[model samples]
Target: MIIVIEPDSDVPIYEQICNQIMEGIARGQIKPGHSLPSVRVFASDLGVNMHTVNKSYHLLEKKGIITIVPKSGAVISSPQDFNESSFNRLKDEFKPLIAESLVVGMTHQQIQNLVTSIIEDFTKNQK
Candidate 1:
């Protein structure tokens, strides 16, 4: 999976890295048990600071999307790690985005359709 970072974007670099990693998981370009490159290597490859990649990995760990092991590296979390708390977290994360979409005048059907299309895109590569 390739992640393109926009230096001029309002979003922080670490957040962009985290978002792309999560999106890669959704698209099946990444999966459970796969090891991510070390923070230093990843940062060097992306031409970003090592601290930025470290922050992204830690945030993903906090979100239960990946696990960091000493001397091993970060690995994607398995589906079994998902639980009710994760579900609530997802809902909480969506609340603000949903509100913004509604505030922007997106109709219910439009929102539903958009979400469905995104889901399809994410699932398309799955077995």
Candidate 2:
């Protein structure tokens, strides 16, 4: 997975990592049963503190997106873990942003087109 971190951003580094990991799962770039890099190894690779990666991994585990096994490492959870109620919850959470996007000159067609392209690209990359 490719992660781009903005140090100056208000979000914490751990959260940034967590968000990217979640996005990777959502896009199917990382499949269920796939193991993620060791926390220490991933932190070293990203030039971040091990605690940062650990925090992100723990967060994923709490969210049911991953499982943390001692000595075995982190593994992506099955897609069956995600439910329609969770998606509805996410949609309700994004309601304001969806309205804001509409007000910001993003037409419905334009938004649909963008999402379609994003999904297409994600699928292509997953292959």
Q: lDDT scores for all predictions?
A: 0.95, 0.87
Per-residue error (Å), model 2, residue 79: 0.9
Error of 1 at 7 (Å): 1.6
Q: Write the per-residue lDDT of candidate 2 for residues 1-127, one digit (tens) a residue.
A: 6988887799999999999888887677788999999998999999999999999999889778899988999999897888887788789977987798899999999988987887787677564
Off-target runs (Cα >4 Å) in candidate 2 are 26-28
C-alpha lDDT of residue 26 in model 1? 91
lDDT of 2: 0.87
Best by TM-score: 1
TM-score of each: 0.93, 0.78
